[model samples]
Target chain A: MAFLSGLSAFPITPSDRGGHVDTAALKRLVTRLCTAGVDSIGLLGSTGTYMYLSREERRRALSVAIDETGASIPVVVGVGALRTDEAVRLAQDAKASGAAAGLLAAVSYAPLTEDEVFEHFSTVARESGLPIVIYDNPGTTHFRFTANLVERLAHVPGIVAIKNPTEKPEEISSHLAQQRSMTPKGFPIGYSGDWSAAEAMICGADTWYSVLAGILPDVCLRMVRAAQNGDVEEARRLDATLSPIWDLFKQFSSLRTVYTIADLLGVSKAEPPRPILPLPALAKEKVAHCLTLLEQDLA
Target chain B: MAFLSGLSAFPITPSDRGGHVDTAALKRLVTRLCTAGVDSIGLLGSTGTYMYLSREERRRALSVAIDETGASIPVVVGVGALRTDEAVRLAQDAKASGAAAGLLAAVSYAPLTEDEVFEHFSTVARESGLPIVIYDNPGTTHFRFTANLVERLAHVPGIVAIKNPTEKPEEISSHLAQQRSMTPKGFPIGYSGDWSAAEAMICGADTWYSVLAGILPDVCLRMVRAAQNGDVEEARRLDATLSPIWDLFKQFSSLRTVYTIADLLGVSKAEPPRPILPLPALAKEKVAHCLTLLEQDLA
Candidate 1:
């Protein structure tokens, strides 16, 4: 459970054009996360294209990541699906495959009711016995999780934590405080959106659920460690230094930007599943430029 | 192509909890649409829980619907998937199975760019050789289609028409006019959202992509016929008469409400795929009452 409290790195699941998991390439990514010592490997997250993969492919990805991590780093698998039964089956697979927790998003196509989402989370948790992290990602799923709903789910038996979307830097403190006050004491609250995640962690958020960390874990880990040690100035300095990469992330979503970075670093050369194209050439140039800047500054 | 012009009924694809299509139940629903003389059958639409079913199940539904309708009606199958290649395959299946056209939504998990969607649609249309209807469903997909994007896609070789989400009733005329002015001449523009569809049809939108019509084709056909014949008063009257059902649709979603209606009317007893629960007891009672009122009034 404590593994859920630090820098959880979400990696892109390396796959071919046909959506089959490149298990060898995926293990390479997981090896990188373990080498950098990310607190947990967020396998099959949105960044991992969990929604695009078949259940068998997802199982393959999780199995590989779990095997690669080898009890050194916990793997938090994304078990979200449009159907509840499918999610339950996914969570079951993650549990059986040795994932530490299942990150469940309210992945919807019907624009689900809060009650339906609650029942969904509750059902998956109860049925699968996998510790669940409530993944509140509205940017993709379009289902926003309100504080009330988050608090309610936080109290559910197997629902242990939340991975909230980032707030504006100035709002991070209050957002964290409000969420902290609403949920059970000591229940971990994490933040995604790499740009603002430093501020969120500096504001005493429990974890940084980061897209950048998925590929560039060492620098992200430095930021998380700085914030963890209460070195607010050091964390802000790293945040400021990474501004160019953050700008790239903002421009060409973190998912696409990191895919380019992973390829540039020779970690994995897989394009995202289609409907999600790789960054265009000019964007790739910008991402490369940002990477060069990050290497110079972070070094 | 002309069949895309009038009352295009979107029936729910009846399926068990496991996402297998109930071909018998589906055939019954399609038979009703055809017997009631709907202009076209929109198989595997959002109301059909197309997003929830597997591609094989989708093919089974489309195949059954096409066979049930025979040559009497054109079946526009929903060919949407999170992956572009999968969508292309679905479109190909629809084409090979004798569907008249493929209804392609910009279904996304990564929150696609307009350019990505343009490519996704273009690729499916080009690769499958199936005529495509741009399914602009922002409510479910959360990917909006601007008029500019629609104009561009409308010009894509195999892309034939669009099924836009409902606009405000008062804005239906201007919305229709704006869309018509932007797209190629005679490119069919349709509206879903059963409540506003009558007004949209009266405003000269080419089709009513109706959820209600999927189950209750006769009454909806009367509304469409009235609008087509330039009897705005009669269409509006029909719209007003169905206000209660629309209200239920607004409250419980047309998909959920229609499922209850289908069961009550002995059309199909299948519930929506999980994560989209059926109407609860109170809501079911309301739906049953509205059906009684509608039966008395429409009869």
Candidate 2:
């Protein structure tokens, strides 16, 4: 549970166009997160293209990540799939492979009811026995988790935490407080939208399930650490300096932008799976310019 | 292209919990569509739980449907998948199995761009050599096809038709006209939402890609025939008679409601794939009552 609270860096699962995992490249990314001392490693998350990869590829990515972390950093694997049975198998794979927990999203194509989603979460938790972190990513899954649903799922045994989509900066406090009041005491509430995550953390969020942290953990760590240490000004300053990057993320989605970032920084040159083309050259150039400006501003 | 017109019956691909295709049940459903004289069979569609089934199961379903139809009715199989390569492969499977065409939706996890979708559709059509129908079911795929995008895709070779979600009764005429004007001449534009499809057909849309017709093809065919024969009074009257069923579809999605109808009518007893639980007892009772009312009215 403690591992669920802090900068849980969500790294992409590098793969070829066929969705075969690049284990060597994945291990490199995990090692970078470990080396930078991210509080936990969020492996195979949305940013990891978890929904796009095959079960074998997902397992391969997790194995490489778990091997790289080596008990030093807790690794939470994304176990979402369109089928309940498939999700259970993925969670079981994560559990048997030594993952810390399984992040389960209500990945739907049928536009499920609340009761269906409840049963899905309960069944996955019961069957897999892997602790669950409710992954509320409406942008991809298209199923938004109500605060009421989150509160209900919180009480389900083996369901430990939630990764909420962050609200705007002005609403983070009330959103965090309402979630706190609704759920059990000590239930970790994390936020993901990278642009607003720092404010969420500063407003006392438990974790930042970050895409930005996946590629550039060092700066993310500094901001998270500053927030954790109660240095509000320092955290805000770091966030302000990274505004250009956030703008790029907002404009061209974090997943696409991060892929470009990983390539630009010589971390990994893997293109996202097809149907999600690499950022066009113009967008890549814009991302590159942001990185240069970020380096100068941080310096 | 002619096969894409008139009443297209979309039957559920009955499958067990493990995602194995219930080939017998599925063949029975396809046989029913053919016997009812539907123009085409929309196999493995959203109502068919296409996204929930595995690749092997999808292939099995398509094979069974194609075999059952036996060149009598064109089978437009759903070939949608999250990845482009996988979609292309599914389209290839459909083509190899003698499916008439592939139904491709912009099934997304990364929340694709218009360009990405354009590329996805173009690639699937070009690579598979199977005629493609743009399955624009935004309710499930969460990717809306802009009129402009549809206009663009219409010109792509081998991309033949579109199955659009119906608009409100008052808007159906203009909506149909707008789509007709935007796309190239002779591009088939069909409507799917069952309640509104009668109105769309009367408004001169090319097809009614119907879920209700999958089970009760006779009633739907009568309506389509009435609209085609310029009997507006008869078509509207038939639409009014089926209003109860439409109410149920609106409340509990066409997919879930149709599953219960399939079971209640003894066409298929297979439950939908898991994570999409069957309707609760009360909903089932309501469906049964509606069927009783429908039988008396039709008689």
Candidate 3:
């Protein structure tokens, strides 16, 4: 929970053409993010393609990231699974691998109840024996965690923070206000849905759980810093630079577009996990243009 | 594929308190459905809580249902998994256990592409050696199979039929129209969203892959028979009788409400898989009232 603020870069799991983890590329990506001074490295995030990899592959990916980053930054490993037992096992593995915390998302193939969702995190929290970050990504999981549910999870032991999606700005603002009013100060709420990160930060989000940071840590850091410093105009300006990539993400998923960006940047050579392909021709051309503009701006 | 038409009853998996599949209850359910002359029995379906159970349990459940039904009717096993390899393995196991066909759903924990989905099913089709029925339940899978994707899958060898969700009647009608225009007559399309079965059937759907049929096969068969005999008025009347339970399904998932209905009927003692709890107290009261009205009408 110590590095629970600022920018947490979620890196893609670089993989070979055979879909095996490309450890060398993964190490390079992690090292680059750490060198760029990202506050933390989130392994196995949606961008990490955690769901596509096997359990052993995912555990290995976590260890490789943690070992490469060393003590320079915290490592938050995504331990989400469709089943509670599988999630608990992954969380335990993250703890054994020296991850700073386990990010848990309740991914369900069946419709889940409020009590069931609460029980899922509570069980993972107790069994993993590591600080847990509740990942409320409804887009991928198709299960929304309402503010009321978040408040209930806040009281569960070991659940120390949250990575909330920022689809609805007004809803995010109202929920953050209600959560802030709750006792014990509530868990620190961070924002994903990178396109809306600036608005969420401006609305008092504690951290930016970002996909953009994974590929372009420096610019993402600058945006987060501007928001943290209350430099609203500067934050908006920095955020505008992410617009081209955001446009592609809106059309497709960030899960697909980010892999293309990483591949284009030569920071990593990852094929987005199978079943999810690399960007199509037009999308790739658009991404290349976006990267060119980003490079010139950074220069 | 002989049993591809009429009512294919998807039984709620009867599970013990510890969540293990209750084989005796499963057998009872299968015997009841088979005796009632339902066209086929679908095991390990969304209603069967396939994702909630582990691989071994799923295989065991399939075997029990197959054994109980004993070729009196075909058994279509839901062989959905997050990984293609896992799905193939399940499909093979279903074949080895004497299941008539494998229901292949592209259930991804990650976002997938059209080509990726095509490959997932095509690979399973070639490898499993079982007749494959593509299960297109986008509500659970989070990945929609466009008519384009379905056309692609229809060309895959061993892919014989489709169990399509009927959430949007217009969309289903449009897609079916587009699909019917393609050569080889394509695969037979079945409807799953029970509340809309009559509409789908009237729209030229080949079968009703029904959850309600698993518990109340006589009533379900009556509806399907009416549809089959071109008794649209009778079909509408029968479908209207399902409205009360359908109301519960719209509120929660059919997976949960059907379990409550089955429990109330004493046909089987079952709970929906973990993370998806059985209906709460108020919902249970509502289901009981609906069942009483239904029972009185049947009498």
Q: DockQ, per-model, please?
A: 0.90, 0.92, 0.53
Largest TM-score belongs to which candidate? 2
lDDT of 2 by residue, A49-82 (tens): 9999999999989989988899999999999998
For model 2, the superposed segments whose C-alpha errors exceed 4 Å read none
Span of 10 residues, lowest total lDDT, candidate 1 chain A: A1-10
**Residue by residue across B1-299, what tens digits does model 2's lDDT show?**
36589999999988888988889888889888889999998888888889888789898888788778788999999999999999999999999999989999999988989999999999999999999999998999889889899999999999999999868989999998898898888889999899998889999999999999999999999999999999999999999999999999998888889999999989899998889999889999999999999999899
Please identify model 1 stretches exceeding 4 Å from their true place. Answer: none
B230 in model 1: Cα distance from truth in Å?
A: 1.3
Residue A117 displacement (Å), model 1: 0.4
DockQ-derived CAPRI band for the predicted complex in model 1: high
lDDT of each: 0.91, 0.92, 0.83
What are the clash counts of all predictions, listed in order?
0, 0, 0
- In model 2 chain A, the worst 10-residue window by lDDT is A1-10
lDDT of 1 by residue, B201-252 (tens): 8888899999999999999999999999999999999999999998998888
Candidate 3 regions exceeding 4 Å error are A1-3, A16-20, A167-178, A182-186, A202-204, A230-234, A265-267, B1-3, B16-19, B167-179, B182-186, B202-204, B231-237, B265-267
Report lDDT (Cα) of residue B49, candidate 2: 87
Please identify which of the two predictions, 2 or 3, would achieve the higher TM-score against the true structure.
2
For candidate 2, the per-residue lDDT at A189 reads 92
Sort order, TM-score high to low: 2, 1, 3
